[model samples]
Target: MSKGTRRLAAGLMVSAGLMGGVVVGTQPAAAYPSNCHYGISSLGTVSAWCAGGSGSVRAVAGCEWFGWWTTAYGNWVNVNQGASHVSCPWPYGVRWGGFNARD
Candidate 1:
């Protein structure tokens, strides 16, 4: 192959490899924690506990008025060795709550 053609092919391969690495290394900002237990109450309380892992957990409450229109987020709790809890306090509406794990 010509030198110019070879250089172009090499540049293409390098760009492809770099792009692949970037994609593979990307991760979600929030994820479910491993070995963690979670629950939600009918009254819009959410809780979570991690038996293991070094991270933080928080509660998320989905509130509904006209529809599912608002979200109530709880404080971040360090769950490396303990539990986290949060509740939705919107009195005029119904709500569903869950948990999220943070790095």
Candidate 2:
């Protein structure tokens, strides 16, 4: 191949690599469920028993948000009863919620 053609191919390959697999979509994609946010306050309420004894356990019902659901029926949680850290897992790639339980 001509030197100029080879250089152009190499430049194109480098540009593709720099893009980091991001595709420029012509239309904007739909947003996540209108309600879910990542925080304890966002997770309205949960039962005390379901809150777990003292480690990183799953959250109880009503303590999560999913795909516009005011309350997530089934959501996993990571609760640290003593240290002051809590985490909520969201399905479908939704945002997870974390909290300072001790605080």
Candidate 3:
């Protein structure tokens, strides 16, 4: 191949490599923490709530308990509730949980 053509090809390859590296190294904000709650408030808005090892909502204040009401406070109706993950009901609950990690 011509010298000028080869140099242009090499430059293109280097630029692609740099862009690929940057794209692969970055993480989205939604993928922040595992077992974190995310959704709207009681009045219907968006917020994020994280959970600790103790399994209680973390760093959230003045929020109502999600799912079920009255004397049966602890009871919930998550489609996939467990020690690892949970999915809340409507815009009135905790909504989503578990790691945002991709496999």
Candidate 4:
């Protein structure tokens, strides 16, 4: 290619790269409730309690069915309120549990 064409191509590529980086870097962060506590019960219950903050928190329970597939369930509660809980269905056992926060 000619020198001018090559320069134009390089400039376009650099501009595209910079724009891509800006888009990737400018993504919004996740909102989570502060001062939260979580737990998993032996009966396949997942719970979360948030004593402070402005967002909401939820309990996430990962349940296993037929010893093969796993599914997740969740329940939400506002911050500074009572606990939120999620439970697996019958014949499904708890594989894991955790909490999530949202605005």
Winner by TM-score:
4
> Which digits, one per residue and each the tens of the lDDT, describe model 3 over residues 11-58?
999999999999998985443234555543454333344443222332
Compared with the true structure, model 2 gives a TM-score of 0.26
Q: Which tens-of-lDDT digit does each residue in 1-103 have in candidate 2? A: 9999999999999999777556653455433222112334344333221233333333333332554433333333334232222333353222443322221
Candidate 2 lDDT at 27 equals: 50
Top lDDT hit? 4
lDDT of 4: 0.81
Off by over 4 Å in 1: 1-32, 92-94
- Per-model clash counts, in order, read 0, 3, 1, 0
Whole-model lDDT for model 3 versus the true structure?
0.41
The lDDT for every candidate, in the order shown, is: 0.71, 0.38, 0.41, 0.81
Q: After superposition, how far is residue 57 of candidate 4 from its true place, in Å?
A: 0.9
**Among all windows of ten consecutive residues in candidate 1, which has the lowest summed lDDT?**
88-97
Scored against the true structure, residue 70 in model 2 reaches a CA lDDT of 32
TM-score of each: 0.54, 0.26, 0.31, 0.61
Per-residue lDDT of 47-70 in model 1, one digit per residue for the tens?
Answer: 777765667887676767655477
- Order the numbered candidates by TM-score, best leading: 4, 1, 3, 2
